[model samples]
Target: MKVTLERTDLLKSLTHVHRVVERRNTIPILSNVLLRCDGGQLALKATDLDLEISEQIPAHVEQPGATTVPAHMIYDIVRKLPEGAQVSLETSGDNATLELRAGRSRFALQMLPEADFPDITAGEFSHAFTLTGRDLRLIIDSTQFAISTEETRYYLNGIYMHTVTTDAGERFRGVATDGHRLARAEVPAPAGASGMPGIIVPRKTVGEMQKLLEDPDAEAQVEISEAKIRITTGNVVLTSKLIDGTFPDYGRVIPQNNDKTMLVDRDDFKAAVDRVSTISSERGRAVKLAISEGRMVLTVINPDSGSATEELAVDYESDPLEIGFNSRYLLEITGQLRGDTASFSFADAGAPTLIQDQGAEDTLYVLMPMRV
Candidate 1:
């Protein structure tokens, strides 16, 4: 293909598709991006067989053709070139090589036949909806950190997205859990999403899709079928196969009726945990929280290393309760709170603790306590 595109435009599109291209691939074509030029636009696509991303950019087309070239190499070449430089791309004579030229720099990259590149078809979707960029980002940012990396429980490696009708009515919900901690967040459901089937969106696709929603003005058109899901907006499309396994029934794990409530400054609690955790044991990273009438004390006792304790005033009036939890889990949960105050509900040291933003009921976290 022979096309001329501004460096900025090409770079913007490349940045989105490159996330799907793996650094190493068992199939050579998996490491390359498919470039097609036609109808006054250029499309770039990349896939690792599980997830695929494609973006179209405006270009001056001299010839209508298509080819595959190394994804990372082309991205680097264009990224390093001077800003506003015009990039000219063309296939070399008979050799199936692609040449990239910008100002005084030029590079020739090995290319493969476009026919060898895999294209994932837009599958049948039973449900489709539109969401603003801000709302879409809130769904991902709030729950993505809880996804599991464990390979055996493949179903837990993604965020569970579905529609739920609460006492307030139908709402779109996202939940993620790694057995130790769980994050659940929801937003008002769009018009046609009632009774939509729940699907587990794989971790990689969640990450790549999150990046695409960074534009404040962008709106996403989401389509879901039995086997795959597609999200498209502003010339970029991401398609991925949903995890086939069923996610664990997360409701059973969420604490039901914990009554004791304690509200503390989020920054203060995070700082105390961070300081005390420094003396915690290497393997457990455990920190103990002792809550009394109106005072909360954080203590870390590592018999082999050292001990630390910090006290903070809190808004607890119930009987004293002591709980131990992994410091990392505490930090992650606290970091996600959007307001200045964080509330925690406790049953006892052994029971699962429930956390929430002081007055917000839509988002909640459940963290299992650790034996100290």
Candidate 2:
């Protein structure tokens, strides 16, 4: 196989495909990327058993063939090569050595047989839809932070995706929780997704898809089967195995009777929480929120350190209530709000508090209170 590619184009493809290769692998072939050259394009693929990414880039093909090489090694070599250098790769028939040349530098790298690479297979998708990159980014960023990191509850380690009917129309909802906090976001459901089964997209897949959606104007084609999910955009394709677990009924956890309400500037609330958290205990980071008629105060206390309190004018007319929460949790949820004001509803000091961005109807958060 002999091919020539510009440094910039080759690096872009390598960076995208290399994300699928794990730094360490139990199988040698799994650590390498499969490169196939034919008809003026080079196909690069890498997989880590659970997720696979493939991309094709334009290249000058002198001789068409296929081979496997160390993914990270090749990426590093190409990344460090002189800018605008023309890269040339050549390997003789049945040979395990790959010759790489660029500028005044040359290197011979070992290659693995292309036949050794594992095939990632998926069944026929029951649902396929298209979402603008912006909509997909909102759904992912709003919920991914709340996904559970606990290994035992494997079911909660991913975002739950399904179609739901709202007053306006049908929409796709994404929900995630770690038992303490929950985040839910919705976007207009793409056509043909009506009867699709709810699926839990694993944590790693969420990250890879987020990276692939960096172009806000690009559209992504999503295909969902019972056990697999695939996302394709531009010249790239990513396939991942869905987590094999049932997500809990998240609707039940969202409170409906919480009537007491407080509206405050989102940035002000976030800043106050950040300031008071300086004195919060390291283990729990608990901060107390005291709300009353037109006033809200945030305070944190630590036995070894001291205490901090900050007051802010708010729009609240409910009975005076005091609630405690983890400072980090409050800050994270508040930071996600897109509007200037954050509206919070409460049942009491002991029940879960519902938080929503005042002008955004597509997202909401629920946080269980902690005893101060």
lDDT for 350 (candidate 2): 95
- Mind giving the per-residue lDDT tens digits that candidate 2 earns over 141-213? 9999999999999999999999999997999989999999999999999997898999999999999899999
Model 1 over residues 89-133: C-alpha lDDT tens digits?
A: 999568878989999998999999999998786568899999888
Instruction: Tell me how candidate 2 scores on lDDT.
Output: 0.93
| Total colliding residue pairs, candidate 1 | 0
TM-score of each: 0.98, 0.98
lDDT leader: 2
Least well predicted 10-residue stretch by lDDT in candidate 1? 118-127
Candidate 1 lDDT score relative to the true structure: 0.92
